[model samples]
Target: MISTGEEVLHGDITDTNAAWLSRLFFEQGYALSRRTTVGDQLDGLAREIEHCSLTADIVVVNGGLGPTSDDLTAQAAAMAANTGLELSEHWVAEMEAKYARMGREMPETNLKQALLPQGAEILDNPVGTACGFVMRINRAIVLFTPGVPSEFKIMVQDQVLPYLKALFPSVVSQVCQRLYTFGLSESGISQTLSSLVVPEGVVIGYRSALPFIEVKVFAPQNCPNVSAFYRTIIEMLGDNVVGIGQPMLSEISGLLQENAMTVSVIEEFTGGALVNELHRDEACASLLKDGRFARDFAKTDKDLASLAEAHRRETNADVVLVVGGKRHEAVSVALAGKGAVWVQQVASKRQYSQSSYRTVIATLALDMLRRYLCGMPVFGHYESLSSLSSFSNERRTG
Candidate 1:
């Protein structure tokens, strides 16, 4: 959950926080289902809390926990639950003493932060002043958090998430692995996954665009053969599984860096997404060839190939990725003596999807990009060969 306090509302903050939190939940194996944002209104905040408390096993509410008048999340949660709130005598004394130690009288309104519902627990904060709260309602656990990211992250990691997981101890350890593939459709992934009854707890999801399939397993934690089973799956899937654990754009770029190699970017339609992925890591920065934004290509009457060639020579970069309009393949024009041939097929049919189109596409591109860089003749597309060797004579052409 994210919120916009009446005074502190900002657009970009919510977008970044949501992505970060979702990644954290994925890492922690939480089945997060809903995300919501509401302007700072105590009534609105209360209603949302009520709704979330009804269905979710654990609801994480972010924002509006400051000492200001407009920061009303704590009070709103009490109202939403039809509970009363009064200052916690112990906390008020604790806070006032802390303020006095700093040689300042504690603002009276700071007492509002100590107010809590009858059954709620106060989450400790080591960094900031705002302390989050937690309580159970309608058989669901609700964890309220400060909107300020640094405070919220600390409280959640140090306290809230651990507490929430304790309530629902996973009977089956949820094990998941992402397998990326290029030159394959969602249907193709389905066909491949359907025949494998390898384990009862394993379920497969086909993500198109980032072009990979994910294998999720809810195997028993005590299962004796889990290691062998994990190895078997990895081996059976072969080189299609690019990198493991966390999805990494840096992994491919890091491998290139270790080999003292470089890569470049040419933007056509993907805006700066591809470029950001390429230049995200310092290791990837080694692969930085000169880049051309879409504006550079369309606004100026520059010779595209010659311009690319000059950048290749100037930066000594090998791989050049060209992003064009959708459904068109992204071609890599490897410099005569530079990087491997990396490619992509991006489509613009996601305007009507019920799933994550960006994840599908981005994951797929990185998977193929990694494999090609690793010297695998990817089976789904062409004959297997050393990626570096195949590009030995590949001139500054796609």
Candidate 2:
């Protein structure tokens, strides 16, 4: 991989494209062997490409394909392939037509974007003028794409993915499944899976995606034992498993919307992150009302419970979620449904970051509320702080 930009190297900009590409390839069961970054320097860029070509079967080059003086990926690619840059009239005309539709003439600087390495095939860009190119160098295939995220994403999804799939059908034919988990720490999860023996030819890897730890398995598409492999993982993860794909904050929000339930938040420890996460979905937005943040709160458990009940009654919400704790103490989360309340706490020492920790707290609170609405046990009796008591006559079940 070739990611070029002085801004990226200098930390003025983040290289999000690399992370996005990693997940994209992983989904197709192709693991990236290596990734290299270089500035707009011609010699360095050429050196990295040459090295990558020798090391991996495919090299993906992103960025530095603009109309500016610093845009040097095309020229660098030509140097690495030991060929000269040549202008393509077809691309020039394509750019001209694209600009014509916008009621403007093509600029001369954009002609640099039309230049491609000798014998390279144009990877058409419908969204932007910086059309990408693909070429073979030694034993590797190199693809150069635009730096703009929108252009890069479209090119990858529409052109690059299909091309790679066709060129390496066997690689793309492999089956991969990802299981997202929340609540469990990475070490805890590792310990849980450490005892299980995985079958040969099936690869299992764990990655931390913030509040969720993604358990990914790659097996041949024709493997009949894949179901058993996933079942073992599910058994180990248990209720901590959120879903099979990437876990989004909108999921919990969508659940509330589907249930036609309104929620109110009384946050003391999570700052406003819980509310912010809920607002990500518009349908979820309607399900949320009376969201408030308290910088300081009562230290006693009784006062906190009274405050949560009062907040729920004032808003007349179907569910009320509360999060509270001191910085050095255990983080506590409470959920109120109708007249019953459930609470759970975890040590703050195990948390990694302030933001991520607060996010986990919020996630736990929401998950509890979700289960409560579904008539599932919010938490085990041992984890519950308050006794099985409610203003309503509904008896708590284990």
Candidate 3:
């Protein structure tokens, strides 16, 4: 196990380098058993270093090796090992002379870095003012590097981790792919591919919203046929695959922008999720004219007629959409819904009627309006609206 510890103070430096180092160890198959953070307190530092060094095969400590008084890593390490810090005869001399060679006297505090544990060997730092080192504690290697990210990265890349890897056993290479999909829930996506062959090593998982989904796979690094496994899964899921790294909604928004299409929506549960997604591209705002919004469950027959009439008169909206609700209230927690869209041309046709439920009446009015902007057929209550142009309704009766 490789353990890392750091001490953070408010305004000195950020510790992202430590986190990146931990990721490197994890990718290399080293068990990162523990990670801890401590303030610049010697007792806390001593306890953390001692505990980590004893528990892990290697304890990588970063930070506090500075000229400042708050930099107590070296002192804490010595204290943890119960060893006294003794100044290096050669190291102390060289650092002082090097600074003098640069036409400046080295700060007296910097002389502190010259100290060495009785059995510890200095790990040369070629890039910065601080020097890192490594030592053994109860059969574990404790590597210490600088706190500054640039210096720390350079030191670890060159000295620290390589030494730790040398002392540690080699692990198998592992690889996994995260596949993203659109238009299905986790269960729905899983069920769609239920008959598909995903291979034994490749697994699938789903995250759902009405128009989007994400499926990811994890497998052993360097697992042979991993590419084939990925390819097969991608083929099985086909267009549902929304590319990688980006989620489905993001991809769809990209597609909408690329195709030069505009999308307007009717606000309901999703509360602007779709409109917000569609307008992710700042350029898309130019294409989107306006959204017709009537967000509530409080519509009677008379209410629906008035709302639709008011909607048609106000926004001249080309397309209307309804989406979103809190998770758990629906089939899947994020399983937001999209209802029919109404176009201004249809509202003027003068044949749309109202329903007892104001929401239904509003959607019906929007569906009549939809035929001009979107040709997707039918808006049934139990049916899910997972895609922009997916549902086909031959039956016009609402």
Return model 2's CA RMSD, one decimal: 3.6
> Each prediction's Cα lDDT score?
0.60, 0.79, 0.55
C-alpha RMSD of candidate 3: 10.6
| Best-to-worst ranking by lDDT | 2, 1, 3
TM-score for each model: 0.63, 0.87, 0.52
Q: Number of the top candidate by lDDT? A: 2
TM-score (C-alpha) between model 1 and the true structure:
0.63
Give one digit per residue, the lDDT tens place, for model 2 in 74-112.
888899999999999999999999999999999999999
Q: How many clashing residue pairs are found in candidate 1?
A: 9
Runs in model 3 with CA error above 4 Å? 1-14, 89-104, 176-221, 236-398
Name the weakest run of 10 consecutive residues (lDDT summed) in model 2: 381-390
Residue 115 lDDT in candidate 2: 89
- The residue-by-residue lDDT of candidate 3 on 1-398, one tens digit each, is 22223334443455576568755665556637777677778898888888787777767887778877777888888998899888877777777777877899888888888776777788877666678888887657888888778888888778866676676546543354666654335676667667876556554555444334656565667667667766777887654455566654444445545555554555554344445545655654565666544445323323333343344345554333433222222211111112322222111112212221223223333333222223333332222332222222223323
lDDT over C-alpha atoms for residue 270 of model 1: 51
- Per-residue lDDT of candidate 1, residues 1-398 (tens digit): 64546543556444555656775675566757888787788888889888888877778888777888888888888887888886777777777777888899998888777887777888887666677788887867888888777787788788977786786667233555554544445565456656656655444444544344455444444555555666666666666656555445656866787777677766655556666666677677656766666643522212434445555667666655544333232222222224323232334333423234433443444554465567654222421111211122233323
**Residue 310 lDDT, candidate 1, scale 0-100:** 59
